[model samples]
Target: MVLIGYWLIEKLFTFEAYKTRNNRGFIIRQITHHKTKQEKERQREKLINMEKRVLYGLVVMLMYLVGGGYSQGVVEWIRDKAEWEEILVKTEIHIGVMVTSPLCGAPCDIVNDQVARFVETYGDRIKFYKINVLETLFFALDYKILTVPTVIIFKEGTINLRFESLSDWGMFYELLVNSSILDFPPDLSPAPAPAPSDSDPDADLPPPLQSGE
Candidate 1:
């Protein structure tokens, strides 16, 4: 939801670019004290509409994902709090999961589509999970999550990093990279024996003791 929101916002800014990329002409007009109040209002109106589309688009995309089309096996979905807790304590390396919603807009949709590749690449380093805010509302309330695509990186059940809104695939990449903080357990094999000494073993024996006696 967060990722798509940002993408939509980016798209909206470009949706109404004035004549050119910079819109420097508008700036020049403003500097010269030219009469351009109507243009200002137009831009404002565009901004307003952009916001509306962002919200609406998010809802539409979320609905589509809730159905069977959402990519499965990309990341394990947490069905209940028991499952969430089990993963937290049992996993040795660290934990990373996303808190999202069924109603989340384009940002969540974008993350849903793009995150599978990173998961496949880094799935060995650490396991990734997704918690539905609607199904598991307790986790969301516990984490104080009000937005979709919030990511929590934790180790041994302790949170290390938290992203309030995941607005792009980069966040997923970062999560995978950081999950390796506690990589595979150290090797536990015994040490090798030392090399044999070169000196004679009986050199210091009682060869001279008999004569002295």
Candidate 2:
């Protein structure tokens, strides 16, 4: 009877130890799974950031290439028109308009290209100013320009005509030309005549023999 009792106690203790070991193994597996999940999440986040950085770099490079490829004249012309507006012979055009974007798109590019061409061709006679919607929010609101490609014609610095969307280029040019703000010939003071040439051989000739004999 004593031996049987000792054997029973030993069996119970062994079973308890086995259960404890199993429970410890389960816990370890759970922890390992959680750690692996965390590592994967971190890796995914890193990949997303790397992709964004690469995309940003590509966009920057594209901008540089486009900017660098344009002819010097085109580049200079763009700069002059953009920067010289303040100093430009403030020509009050019968047409002034606010453009909302500088981005490249179907109709946007078409409209912008036309405007740039107009500015380059008749810039001396008329002034066309463009302000980006994102950059010049205040100016847009001040002019009540709520949409892109808005055309506004100004005379004496006050709004006179406005149109949204594309329209006939000829009509716009005509309006600008007749605005009277643009000095038709551009008031250029005449340059003083070159001083009578000092090498003139005619000046030294004795007064023509008072009319032929």
Candidate 3:
């Protein structure tokens, strides 16, 4: 039975790898056909790098599976290292919404909606990320997340604010405003005209003559 399972796993991975190779070849052909000499060389280099990354990923997965999950420690270590690297190296202010699956009901739904709106509103200024706790337990544990629909804001590689079970958009907005992470939505109203100053020679000039005067 174990041997059969291993064979099945190998076949599955082989099929996936074959598909990936076909796709990669097609993309490379297209790149070569369209690009000039310099661009073609650069693009081919990039494709080769991408292929290496994909192959490395597959090898890592096969090793894990073939070894009967013996690579679990190595995988965890890599994940932790990558997480810390991201936290420390990223320059943008990060807003992470941690939620359970969509099937978790009303709270998750609310969080999803609010997170979408928040991203749409402030996406240019902040980096927004969503973590599904059910799918990514490593992130949940790393962030010490204990509740569903938790929101965490990170500034300068440190946790700035964390709120659990947030359901109200208004309250969340207020928190962001109060914490000075985000300024209140700019008043779309036009700025008042500056008071005329003695130094403004242009203002003293009479309005330009209208055409056909």
Task: Give RMSD to native, each candidate.
Answer: 20.0, 17.6, 25.0
What tens digits encode model 3's per-residue C-alpha lDDT throughout 1-213?
999999999999999999999999999998887777778789999999677556545544554466442211111122344665665576565545444565555455444444554555666556655666766777777788777667777777778778885544325545654665665455789999877788876976789888894
**Better structure of 1 and 3 per lDDT:** 1
Judged by lDDT against the true structure, how good is candidate 1? 0.68
**Model 2 over residues 78-121: C-alpha lDDT tens digits?**
13334434523455443344465755233444344445545655
lDDT, candidate 3, equals 0.61
Return the TM-score for each candidate structure. Answer: 0.52, 0.38, 0.43
Cα miss at 57, model 1 (Å)?
7.8
Which is the better candidate, 1 or 3, if ranked by TM-score? 1
How much is the lDDT of residue 63 in candidate 2? 39
Count: clashes, candidate 2: 4
Candidate with top lDDT is 1
Off by over 4 Å in 3: 1-88, 167-170, 183-213
- Tens-digit per-residue lDDT, 1-213, candidate 1: 999999999888776674575578778877666446767888999998789658656654664567444354368789988887788889876567777787766666556554555566555555678888888987987788877788777877788777764344435555555555446645679989865555976655557545553
> Clash pairs of candidate 2?
95-153, 96-152, 96-153, 97-152
Q: Cα RMSD (Å) between model 3 and the true structure?
A: 25.0
User: How do all the candidates rank in terms of lDDT, highest first?
Assistant: 1, 3, 2
In model 3, where is the ten-residue run with the lowest total lDDT?
Answer: 69-78
